[model samples]
Target: MNKNLIIGQFTDAYLPITDGVVLTVKNYAHWIEKKYGKCIVICPSFPKFIDEDNFDIIRFFSIPMPLRPPYRMGIHYLDLKAIKRVEKIPFHIVHAHSPFSAGLFALETARKRKVPIVATFHTKYYDDFKSATKSDFLARIGVDIIVKFYEKVDQVWTVNSSTAKTLKEYGFKKEIEIIPNGTDIIPPENLEEYKEKINKIYNLSQDDNVFLYVGQLILHKNIKMLIESLYYLKMKGFSFKFLIVGTGKDEKYLKDLVRKLKLDKEVIFVGRIIDRELLKGFYARADLFLFPSLYDASPLVLQEAFALSCPSLLIKGSNASEGIIDGYNGFLSENNAISYANMIEKLIKNKPLLREVGKNAQKTLYRPWEKVIDEVVERYKELIFTYKKNF
Candidate 1:
């Protein structure tokens, strides 16, 4: 059987731009093209390069996003003229990533073309809205907009079970598929070299335990909480180096906090590193991964850490902690400073437990992209078959 596939995605951000959405989309697009020939990625044009043989990227004109909060909601103005360009192509499926302006345009195009529309629930926008706007009223408006936007799609997919539940709560009638993120396992040989490079950059000792934190420095990430916990440990005379990977709007604030708390020597913020292999190496070398995010939905970093057998310290109730079994593969703590500090102290006091948890974490294998793409392909086939039958 011959198949022609065109995927329409609306993301507030894309590559050269860092976030979970960009990572998910890039991974999905790469896997789909490798398996099914070619796929098109639609988003705002950024300076990043999308160099895949079978992938065609379409960037719509957009304004510069605000630097203070760091996202693509307010900055994007849907160029109906640019969107009109997609109408010229014969697309089979329209897949949107966000519920912002670009998503609305995608939905409209799908309806006009009479094609199947599929959307993936990505960001926890409502939670983010509350934090950025500080208005529950506005946050409610955002939730309503998301509900209305998603209601028009044929299929909805989420990265975690918690997000699926959230979709159902929002009055979505369609079945929401739960598909977690996946990563290519890093080889042991490469990890050793990566460790040496990282040690040289940070001046690390072989005896020192390095706790790594990878991802944005956002308020919702609750990185301050992690710094506070480290401060608490220092108060008790515990010594360890924290290697913070990635950068964001919170860099200056976090640096200030670290200095104010006298953790300048213990904490190192090694701003955003682009090399994927280097990131995987850091994951493998770390004694433990610290992610104290108070709000998230299945962050890819957690899965990356798991793939590398890096034990994690995650905050409870966050979507990333869903599949985690506390005390087995990682430790879960509340959002409070004391609770997080206590968990870190426990790990410091019991070194053997860390090794055991890392071993346990290695046992989990997540193949979400494979499974999700298979399901998506099957859905495409069904949609095409039904379209022919109906017409």
Candidate 2:
């Protein structure tokens, strides 16, 4: 077997996006370099700094995204230009993240270069379209675009099994691989100190149970539902603090709702904590992690919380639900605020259940990056071999 493998990864969003897709690709690229011989990452250029000498970066034109969440659609002209640049590189396999411009560009580049293309389904754009426009026609059109893009790739990889089933429903004939995103476990020493500092900073009392919500504060994330659940818990005389750790356009709106509900003392919005260690510390200290997202393929936050032994209350109708076994690892609830509140109340009433779920959740582990990369590399070799044989 050839030890030297050249892999090309393309995504529309990169660092500064502060979302799961960008972080997943960045982490995967770093792991590939550490485990494999060589790899290159292609993304739209940003003003922010990304220091990785081993990996090559191909910058392209990206439009300013407004109310689109983390995705800023890449221009076709710029993507074609990026495609040209990637075609010149010697890569054994091409891995595309987004099914829009970057994925389209990767498909073209792979076909021209005669390299096998592997696409990882990251975002649930169809779900986002529904939340943003609330138009079935627009969502259908979005689904059509994504279906066409993935039809050309050799192998499809979804972050979770539910996403894989979704891809199959969209007429994807290729074998779909379920490779859930993995997070580096936070060291115990770092987590312990981080917990004390964060609690003090947020003015969280030692007796008050703190529930953490860490992700983009948007309509799709269902932050309003989370706030309502907190209100419900308060009504029940549950002494708990809700920590909001993220920034988005909906920040002010969520804060307003908090005030309207008179949850001023109960809710704290700590915007965009960039430090990974500090974020993990908050996870370690939290009594429960709340994820009210209505649409998500595989949220890294849920995985991070699980890894840190923080039991979560994840909303149903998302790929993240694949990891939850109902009352075992975490609670899954309907999209409605009332339903979510019911779940929260259940957790508050049964504190022992929370600890039991968290203990069980720690056992549900994801495939290591080395194993995932090895599977990818083996797939690449098979593709190369088949292509050579046919030729």
CA displacement after TM-score superposition, residue 376 of candidate 1 (Å): 3.8
> What are the lDDT figures for the candidates, one per model?
0.76, 0.78
TM-score of each: 0.91, 0.91
Minimal lDDT window, size 10, model 2: 365-374
Off by over 4 Å in 1: 1-3, 47-54, 67-70, 73-81, 170-174, 184-190, 368-372, 383-391
Clashing pairs in 1: none
Model 1 Cα shift for residue 272 (angstroms)? 0.4
- The residue pairs in collision within model 2 are none
- Give per-residue CA lDDT, model 1, range 1-391, as digits (tens): 3344656555667776778888777766776676764567777765445544357777777666675534444223456566667777677777788877667767877788888777889777778778778999998787888888888777778887888877676666677876566664443555678777778778888778789999998877988888998899889888899999988887889999999999989998888878877787788778889998867788878878877778899988887788888989888999888889888888867778987887788676344466656766776667666766775
Q: What local lDDT does model 2 show for residue 32? A: 75
lDDT of 1 at 38: 55
How far off is residue 153 in model 1, in Å? 0.9
Cα lDDT tens digits, model 2, 273-377, are 888777888888888899877577778787688777788898776777886888898889998877888888778778788878886887774334456666766
